[model samples]
Target: MDRAPFHPGPPAEVTATPAGDRWTLRFVRDLRHPPERVWAALTDPARLREWAPFLADRDLSTPGDAVLTLVDGDAVVAQPATVRRAEPPRLLEYTWDEDLLRWELTRTADGTRLTLWHTVADRGLLPMVAAGWHLCVDVAERLLAGDPIGPIRGAEAIGFGWTELRDTYARRLGDA
Candidate 1:
């Protein structure tokens, strides 16, 4: 039997909240997989490479300093990160460069609810950030379902409707 093609859904459910001088983008996604499975994808280096926007040098399951290399085709930029909190398949908070990322995983009746609070210095980048993460989680969900479509991020995401999602998110989120 032929497999069905994968097409990412619409923009994720995201909202922007003010955090000191910076802004925090709250992105929520519900997956059909459990928390343990999703947590591995978010913490494991090899699994992160398959879906995340960056490649982790070490497992993010522990609280410590780690390096995350952002790759955009031939361009690779290594950024310093610190895992401030790690609570198994529940909460994981870390810093990526100057930005702070907090992940909360809650078990749901159907599967798991994943919420990402990313603190960024710029408010204008919220929509773009949401769009990028929208694709990342979508791909991650696919990977968990045993139907990986590879990672969609960086410049390459433009070819996979990233621009459209960004625009849509911008309109949905509006300017505050």
Candidate 2:
């Protein structure tokens, strides 16, 4: 049976390495679309909401500084995310809590090369975090190609991402 084209396997040449508790996911896809088109998909709030599940409501057209709100069921996670690195059709970075989230886009011979890096909470929530980020990247790629892929349900929906939140605190030395 043929699979839906909305989701594509990570580009054959992709790499992920452990960085302390954080992980770095770097891959390059030859998206058929132009960088400007891809950039807007990454920066526009309406487009973002369409692709990313956590974002219920937010605006990005007036891109400068804003308080971003992300929802996971009844709980709401708000972070003061800023466009730290903006190069237009190139790089975008912001603060997702303490960890830094960045997206690096390059206009390649084939298409746009995107590098998404997130220094989010790991150890306990690592697996779910990885899955969520992985899904986000998939959605971005699909959206650009005008595929019918849907927004991803965050780690919370599966009941595993939050299960390990307490483990992070237990690791503190002499904290018992």
Which has the greatest TM-score?
1
Question: In model 2, where do residues sit more than 4 Å from their true spots?
Answer: 1-8, 11-30, 56-64, 73-75, 121-127, 155-176
Scored against the true structure, residue 156 in model 1 reaches a CA lDDT of: 89
lDDT of each: 0.91, 0.58
Candidate 1 lDDT trough over 10 residues, lowest sum: 1-10
lDDT of 1 by residue, 1-176 (tens): 11246566866788999999999999999999999999999999999998999999999999999999998888899999999999999999999999999999999998999999999999999999998999899899888998887887699888877888888888877852
Best by lDDT: 1
Q: In model 2, which range of ten residues has the least summed lDDT?
A: 167-176
lDDT of model 2 at position 45: 77
Angstrom error of the Cα, residue 161, model 2: value is 15
The TM-score of predicted model 2 comes to 0.67
**lDDT for each residue of candidate 2 in 8-109, tens digit (9 for 90 to 100):** 344223344567867554434556677888888877777886566456234443346666667656667877766677778788777655766677778888
> How many Å off is the CA of 33 in candidate 1?
0.3
